[model samples]
Target: MERGNRRNALWLKQVIVLDSSLLIAFKIKNDSHHERANALMKQVVSERFGKPSITSYIFDETVTGIFVKSKSLRLAVEYGNELLASLETLEVSEEAFREAWKIFSEQRNRRLSFTDSSTLAVMKIHDIGRIATFDEDFGNIEGINAIGLV
Candidate 1:
């Protein structure tokens, strides 16, 4: 196979966990990561890559974060609903929350948010290796790699 085709095939085998930072960047026009997030969206829509997934907690975080940062409940609700309707949202069980809480409690030095902890928990559960995010913290993680830079 040609190099470009090989890259596309590899991309097809990957599943990316959608992080709040990328979603927020796409939802808000003025966000620093907007352009890169837009490019990622194009890839998703073009189906050149694997479908994206997000945990229920990440969904909540993205929606709430959008509202908090944008100060517009309408945009938040609209984007939240759109994501729920479109994306493959992973569930957050008690076990998952417990795992996330454990990580949050233990990672005092990392300052990882409970929401980010939930993302980690969900990604581990689903065996996902890549995260669509602008945050550098994901880069510090063991199993997961972050994509979609600012």
Candidate 2:
């Protein structure tokens, strides 16, 4: 399916993207944001933030982060599998990639990674207004509500 079509197929307005930082914190017990992640997750489950979703790029970042931090391939795989089974994983389109590259190239002050740029691009393209993230970078972006960030 085409990227736009795939996005439109889902309920966009009520969808909230789950960022890597939030996922990592939720999985890793030692993470400082662990408790907050749990609380945010409860809100998500209660439908306060709408249906939870994640991009393909976020899935990669999350699983890799879990493995690197925990040094447990089994744990990472388990969490990855759980995510794949539970959440709606949206694939980033070429148009979104181009937009992300543009954002990455144009940003001079805010140090956002390519993945972060991609998240923003995907959200904009899909008209997704909310994100469950612990990353402070998303806080300043207009039209996006960065949930779970202080």
Candidate 3:
């Protein structure tokens, strides 16, 4: 592909809504996918993927992961703060909660975490179809596309 075509392809993909797992992977240096995740982040931020946003659930998860998984609490806090500063925080609204509740209740065979559903709800509200997530569960959903695993 031509260089312009490649750039256009990447830009036309979709907005990226980052899940906790992917954000944690980017935050914690030890994460196996850190390099790839970091490269993705660099491109997304520099190129501008319709302004990235992370649900509050994901923000909490990142901080908790750092505290629980990292070797040093101080280091974890440092990185956690850095990550928090960078993200656009999205609060879970009543409508989002209701939507998530409906999605979970309708899916008898699958279990969706309230947090995960909330993230999906945000994407739905914002008209975002793409997400950065390590979990494969999002792919099972009809409208949203999980870009990280792909």
Candidate 4:
């Protein structure tokens, strides 16, 4: 499918990849984008954006970020457990990791992190065309729509 068509199809199916930035914002009340994240999550739960999926890399990043920022291991574990129970978590295969490495090496201008590259790889491998993210880096990527960014 064409990129636009794929995005439209994804929208109709309510399928989107979840990004660590969005997760962090939603979990951290003091975050600058907390309110926006909450609103987006509410829409997500209502199926306005379809079902959200996350890769293992994103889960690690989110839980680590929460713990680092909150300094509360309990809160981090709680959030992690909630996510494990509520969201569909995709594993990053070895193929995806190689693809991510390629993307990371090929990018000279964009500063996408290794985990972000892994997310992109996972999305491509899974045929997912949309992502819910607060990170602006995703805006520069083609063939995929980045939602929840202002």
Candidate 5:
């Protein structure tokens, strides 16, 4: 019984998927969601929780968008680099893709964007039950749980 409990504890500490909104919010200091995202990130990075992970696609999407919108290139680059460094990169797998496709098909009328679909895919594949996103669309996604601030 003790061994089983220990195993469950260990499994619960595994990686949790990080979303692009979280990174973007964390990087842009003035954004309304910045503080919320930062607080959530701190918990993820703390000793008791699992490490933060995101797909490479999310990485590119966030870093590019953040930097592009920033007036100060240097500051944007610095924040973007720091945000990227804090995360563990996960490569999207075939299984993830299939699951995302299924979600998309089921919600075809909703018109879920590719970005959110990909994130949902990664979450389903990795058994990640929570996502740190500021977008409500993520919450609408079935199967994948979203941790949006809304």
Candidate 6:
């Protein structure tokens, strides 16, 4: 029904969007979702299902997550570089980016960060219906589905 490769496989969440949580999980071995995230990463790289895309904002979040976890700026940078090798980065206009950031910041929900909101916004904008993330809040978004659950 999707009219692409796999042709009739409508159950698959094609055109996946990468999330910072999943990336962080992949990098941190001790993370709760590490194994699942690692397996998802392997699938993304090996199977090459639709070009997995991430926003610049999410990229920053991921790198920052790595830094906070490892407490090493150098290691964070290295991990960011290694992680970038597997996905596509999506860039948006400054005004749009700022607006999304502002809207998410005003929301009082502690579980969903500004970065998570931005990830949702980007997914909506690009029609990316699936994401690789541990955040269940993503499922609340109308059109986006977060995969890679452990």
Candidate lDDT (C-alpha), each:
0.81, 0.93, 0.74, 0.89, 0.71, 0.73
Question: After best superposition, candidate 3 residue 91: deviation in angstroms?
Answer: 1.0
TM-score of each: 0.82, 0.93, 0.77, 0.90, 0.74, 0.77
Query: What is candidate 5's local distance difference test score?
Result: 0.71
Question: Candidate 3 on 16-106: residue-level lDDT in tens?
Answer: 7788777778877888888878887886687455556677877777778777877678967887677678766777788888987877667
The total number of steric clashes, by the backbone 3 Å criterion, in model 4 comes to 2
Cα lDDT tens digits, model 6, 84-143, are 786667765565567668758776554677777776666655556888788876765656
| 1 versus 6: better TM-score goes to | 1
- Quote the lDDT for 150 in model 3: 59
Q: Give me the candidate number with maximum lDDT.
A: 2
Q: lDDT ranking from best to worst?
A: 2, 4, 1, 3, 6, 5
Flag regions of model 6 displaced more than 4 Å: 1-14, 98-110
**Alpha carbon lDDT of residue 60, candidate 5?**
76
Clashing pairs in 3: none
- Candidate 4 displacement at residue 34 in angstroms: 0.4
Clashing residue pairs in candidate 2 (N, C-alpha, C atoms within 3 angstroms): none
Position 138, candidate 5: lDDT: 70
Q: Count the backbone clashes (under 3 Å) in each candidate.
A: 0, 0, 0, 2, 0, 0
lDDT per residue as tens, model 5, 1-150: 599886755553476677777888887888888889888877867833466677877877787768776767687677657766776777767777777677777775576667667777776655666676787777665555566556
> For model 6, what is the alpha-carbon lDDT of residue 5?
44
- Model 2 compared with the native: what TM-score? 0.93
Off by over 4 Å in 3: 1-15
